[model samples]
Target: MSSAHITFDTTGDKIARRVRKMRSSAVRDLFAAATRDDVISLSGGMPAVSLLPVEDVRAATLAAVESPEARAVSLQYGPTNGAPGLRAVLADMMRDLGIRVKPDQILVTTGAQEALSLIAEAFIDPGDIIITEGPTYLGALQAFSAFEPDVRAIPFDDEGMRMDLLEEELKRIGKGNPRLKYCYVIPNFQNPGGVTMVAERRRRLLELAREYDFMVVEDDPYGRLRYDGGHQVPLKAMDENVIYLGTISKMLGPGLRTGWIAAPESVLARINLVKQGADLCGSSFDQIIVEHYFKDIPWQKTLQKFVAVYKERRDTMLAALEEFFPPEATWTHPEGGMFLWITLPDYMDTDSMLAEALEAGVTYVPGNSFFPDGKTGRNSMRVNFSFETPESITEAIRRLAKVIEDRLELYRVFIEAGALPGYDRKEAAMTDEKTPTPWEEVVADSEQNEEAVMQAREGNAEQIDIAEEAVRDAQQAAAPAEEAAE
Candidate 1:
């Protein structure tokens, strides 16, 4: 809720209005469970860091500090923007994507995550509006929410963010509205929702940006990790003014934490000033290592190895989904991305099922993490293939499938007892209605059929091992979702 709309009573110290708007990353919260050996985590888009040879990593670090002069440069504080030679190397890398930018225009950020926060700080003010894909990146939402912008999410199809929908939204907001700031998009292999923005949508989006008078921010972290399919043209390649964010986090290694932003000099200048205050400068040590890694070695061959492994894992997950998931469930088959999205039945409520999933020995990010409201995408979840083995990926899907089936079976029990307003089990499963079953009514109705519900469960030998407690938890969790829909 916006602080402007209501006075939230704080217990002790007053929290900043901007801080109150901030949201924690849900994926980060899953790490505790992900660390457990018993759980198969399909939560993070973690790169396969194991694919890189240990010797290569050691060589990169040693090369960065090979001599006294190199050590001095690596350890000491460097330029606020970045080391010029490092920026030059990043520029040459960008050239591969058909983007031309001078090293002077590129501002090296701690990581693309820092670039996200810096952009928000520089451009967004309270009540300002920014556009993103309907289910955009969770990290980006966390960064933007701190500034309290009205994040308008435009829905996307397989080709990507619907330009027609964007046009309609723009008209509704009015052309040249000063409140409308910039549009943020991950053009290739988008996070959470693994659909790429097609070339036609790209051209139309840029054209609309000019007509509407707002800048475009392109965050391309997954562009280089393509498993198969040809690359789509980057937004920055078409427009010189677009703010382009790139990183070595996916390719070289996330531990390096190095990324850069290329924008118009005016915009870069403002962000550079903001960056200096955030951290004196990003680790000069990390920057030195990144420079040596990309500039000194054959990085492309290692990236191909990463791609091949990801492709096999992706195939494994896809086959598992087809074999195990229910008919009511559907998923995205991405051409080249680390994660795929699974959308369950309208009433399945993925957020409400997370507890059950944890108990089932697999963890996934409920789709609510991707949206600003945190409750709108309750029927979907994001699954990752880049972090786990092919065997683990297959087993994780099987476990996840059981969780979905358990929920569906519970709903069927309610319908059978006249607790839910559906004709039968098949009708209820296929229903497109958004309204959830009434909690109070279902509880009241369940008393009379408690014996029958239990009996039905005991008779089904193949049912997932969802205990009474798990079933109750799922049903109770829906109350808040019911309120959100209202």
Candidate 2:
């Protein structure tokens, strides 16, 4: 065959439909820009790996490889369900959290990422309804998107997912509807929003699950990382209907890529079958190393240390926000976890302002991506405090504040000049006492300058000219009043 006839565009047509729908992770994309020495990144759900107990990890690795029996298991292929010892260790850990599960109930995967994927694979079907918090974890949204589920996001408050709103939605969907597959939640230190579910809400959620006859995927990667708060029990602890996801990524390091799912054996069996097709099994050596670390090291002490370091960073960021940010800006005060959400004025779009923020030497994941439907959260962004140092975070917040102030001022000018399309004068007057100049008045006063105003609106001429002319006219109009008072 001729070369032209044989040539193929693999990405153009050969790619799977699901793969084509996958969008690049916003946090991952920001990593490249964040690497610059001058840039302070409050992006990415990254833990401070530098603070991890280096000696303990080194010792664990040695024990896993140096011993003959351990070496054989580490190097060889293992069971698809995960190594026995690791499951037992995790079971014991879960017991501490009040979740009673046997080793057989657990299905180990590459990481929490893969566990999410496996769950999505086993349960999600096209057009199935999957409920999540309004500003939920982006990674989970990405995972479920491949399966083409109808993702419905419910708004959350400081206490977490509004059960009242959930009940309303559930009522709409009707009780015991098979089309409703599952509800995914980050109960402890939820991603992006950083709001933990309160005990009352947790109980109500289980009750809803029971009434609605659906599953709850409880993602608890950050549950143990609480810095300052009373410990809230995981939903799985209260009920077995929850499919619990646990990870060593936040606690130890993400490099291990080890995570587990504690679910009913029936569900786990289905997940195991899907996992077999996905990757067969997780890394044998890494699982063994984690098992060793849990057995030999004071893991609880390590968790305490992580809390101390991250709590300082979180506090620093919060204090800096209070000192530097505009009064209109508001943010979540998370008790624990890597992220806190900030909401800017409704007129501000974080997505549009990202380039300016990056130019100002800081980066954040714009909040819109966290919403599955992408219809809201335009005025918000998720700020991560776990990766950067306190000094870096402080400086980053300062830069971000400047960007917000500049953007807000520009937006105000646009609205006042009637340069912005669909500007509502009545709404502006009600919200702020500074009444917006009528477009007709602006036009009537500047009849000779009509060409300039039109040019400014069309981007054919400088906007500064229009703003300056309006300011000058307003000042000139006020001069007589000031003289009369004198």
Candidate 3:
């Protein structure tokens, strides 16, 4: 007798509930678009790896593996926390950032990315409340999301996350909320936003963390790469309650995948337990290479080179934006770090315009993805300056500007035709709301209005003529008002 053929269908039922809720990274999607030869990408917080000290790295690799003793150590399984020597080195590095921690307190992970994941695993449970800056690091959002945390995003300004708003949120969360996990922040040259937390605010943040009995995770991947202005002390420097994360990805090559978490030993112990079940340990070989590089090579010189090259690229992008962007567009002038934020006219949705931007030979990460709730920053984008050369950066900005100009012109037409009621460029620019009308709705309204106008023109010439005359008068009347508002 022939056995009956059997097949099992494992659709959504087999997937974890948390995994089902996770969204794909918008920056990764833009990065894929950028892989095309014709598209220039200002997405992804990628360092200028071309500027890395290749000769030094090569030498370090050789030194790390030449001896039989060294090879054995690298090849063998190591401590879950990290290699002791590298942890010591990382401890010294943290001291330079004003964080005093023993080597035992440092938990070296695969990279800062894994460090973030470990923190989430150690601290967060389902339905826990995790606070972060509005438009915070997308990767951090992805990391915390896996634990099913309720992320509360507080808005930020040029200085950084607004303390007033954060304080109010904490009070609302209440001091007795056991589900409140921690406040995760990229305090130095924060990803996407590129706003540094001021020292006074940093102190206040520590004070609040203590009073509220919540930990503060200070992710400081870009702190040392300052191109201008004095350095602000890290949050960890002032408070032992702060958990500091540092990575060699920006300083050295990201391929090495070396990063460390400097926190209290008790916290490190808990994270190490979670980490063992995740990957057991990071690449033992990579940690050794990082150790040799830090010990033998002039890492500070490499950092200086990165700052010089990246600063030039940043300046080029800024200058190009000034010359090519529409009058209604505004962007941040970041002192350092890979990214700068741009805010377009409110009605313009960067996510909707991304297709047009790629068609125009440029790409950017839509700003909505950076938010915890993905509700705000519809009219914004994050642009990276470190990955592209100055010439390419200029050309990319010029291409992006054309797309913006075309979109803005379309919006103007809709306004002139009275399709968008009570919506003027000036009024839209001044208001800040948590939710705006979705771009699809706006486009649908415009299309319906345009069809109505076309039907009127074809069926009744007299009515069409009157409508055109009235539109002309409206445009003429609004010209002076727009100019006065400007």
Tell me, by lDDT, which candidate is best.
2
Kindly list the per-residue Cα lDDT of model 2 for residues 311-351, writing each as its tens digit. 99999999999999987678899999999999875556688
Over the stretch 1-486, how does candidate 1's per-residue lDDT look in tens digits? 665775666653677878866777888999999999899999988998989978778888997799999899999998989988899999999999999999999999989999999999999998999999989999999999989999999888889999999999999989879999999998888898888999999999999999998889999999988876788889999999999999998898888989899998999999988998999688889998898888988999999899899999999999999899877677888888799888865555787678889999999999989988887777789999998999999999999999889877865655544444333434454556444333332333332344444444467533323444444666687679989999
Pull out the clashing pairs in model 2.
none
Report clash pairs, candidate 3.
none
**lDDT scores of the candidates, listed in order:** 0.85, 0.87, 0.85
**How many collisions per candidate?**
0, 0, 0
lDDT of 3 by residue, 62-104 (tens): 8778999999989889999999989988887777777888898
Q: What is residue 364's positional error in candidate 3, in angstroms?
A: 0.6
For all predicted structures, in order, the TM-scores are: 0.85, 0.88, 0.88
lDDT of 3 at 104: 88
Which stretches of candidate 1 lie above 4 Å from their native place?
Answer: 1-11, 414-486
Return the clash pairs for model 1, or none: none
